[model samples]
Target: MNGIEHYRRAEELMEQATATRTNKSGFEVCYVTNEEQERLTRLANVHALLALSAAQADATEFKRELYRANGEELPAAQSAKERAEAKTARNAALAAAFID
Candidate 1:
């Protein structure tokens, strides 16, 4: 799912969170609906980014770490352009997840 950028999906979650969050737990619970599925996908994407940030390890090791961290392992893809795109997408997702 490397090429499957979930950035906009994440933003959609933020919007939902903003719209539906009426209490302390509302925001947290809003992430589970089918309407917020993209947000969950984007969260997984950002968590994967944390694992992918390791520079010294090979792809398999990265995959292992992500799984160990309970995140999904994105498929093996070798291309600078793709990586750049993924990074951008992940950043957008992170902003959506963290920035509100």
Candidate 2:
């Protein structure tokens, strides 16, 4: 699936996790258990990350293509090790942002 598809799936999961229903008495109620909700939220986050990664890759590819079309020498790409470290740091920051 593409980035937009993954993003849409993530949004759908998030909605399911937090959705409220009107009970017969006309009060809003959540049917999902805490554990289930947490699981759904985690899944949503995974999809969101996948979408973000795909988007970044697409952007990089587009930039490379544009440079090529302009007869410009492409900039050196990051080494695999550098990319891994950057991804690790980015993930750490994202995790930290979710901490209480």
Candidate 3:
């Protein structure tokens, strides 16, 4: 699926995960366990990263085209490797948050 579709799916999952109930004493309770919630969040983050990657690629190409058309220099930005490393670090943090 496209990045935006992935992102939308992640949002839907997050909404589903937030579903809660009132306990006997009226305290709010999440339907899913903490581990399950963490897993969902991790998945959502991955989807978000995918969307970012797609959007960045689109933006880079658009900028390149615009610069070429105008005979101007393109602006500097993070390389794909740097972006991938950042995404990896984010994913690692998400995974670590749920570790025992």
Predicted model with the maximum TM-score: 2
- The C-alpha stretches of model 3 lying farther than 4 A from their native spots are 24-27, 71-100
lDDT of 1 by residue, 42-76 (tens): 67567456445433345667678888788666656
In model 1, the worst 10-residue window by lDDT is 1-10
> lDDT value for candidate 2?
0.96
- 5-67 per-residue lDDT for model 3 (tens digits): 988988977876777899999999889988888888888888888888888988988989999
| Superposition TM-score, candidate 2 onto the true structure | 0.71
Candidate 2 on 1-100: residue-level lDDT in tens? 9999999999999999999999999999998889989999999999999999999999999999999999998877899999999999999999999994
List lDDT for all candidates, in order.
Answer: 0.60, 0.96, 0.86
Using all chains and alpha carbons, the TM-scores for the candidates as numbered come to: 0.25, 0.71, 0.58
User: Candidate 1 at residue 43, lDDT?
Assistant: 73
| Superposition-based RMSD of candidate 2 using all C-alpha atoms, in angstroms | 12.8
Candidate 1 global CA lDDT score: 0.60
Inter-residue clash pairs, candidate 2: none
By lDDT, the candidates rank as 2, 3, 1
* Model 3 CA lDDT for position 86: 91
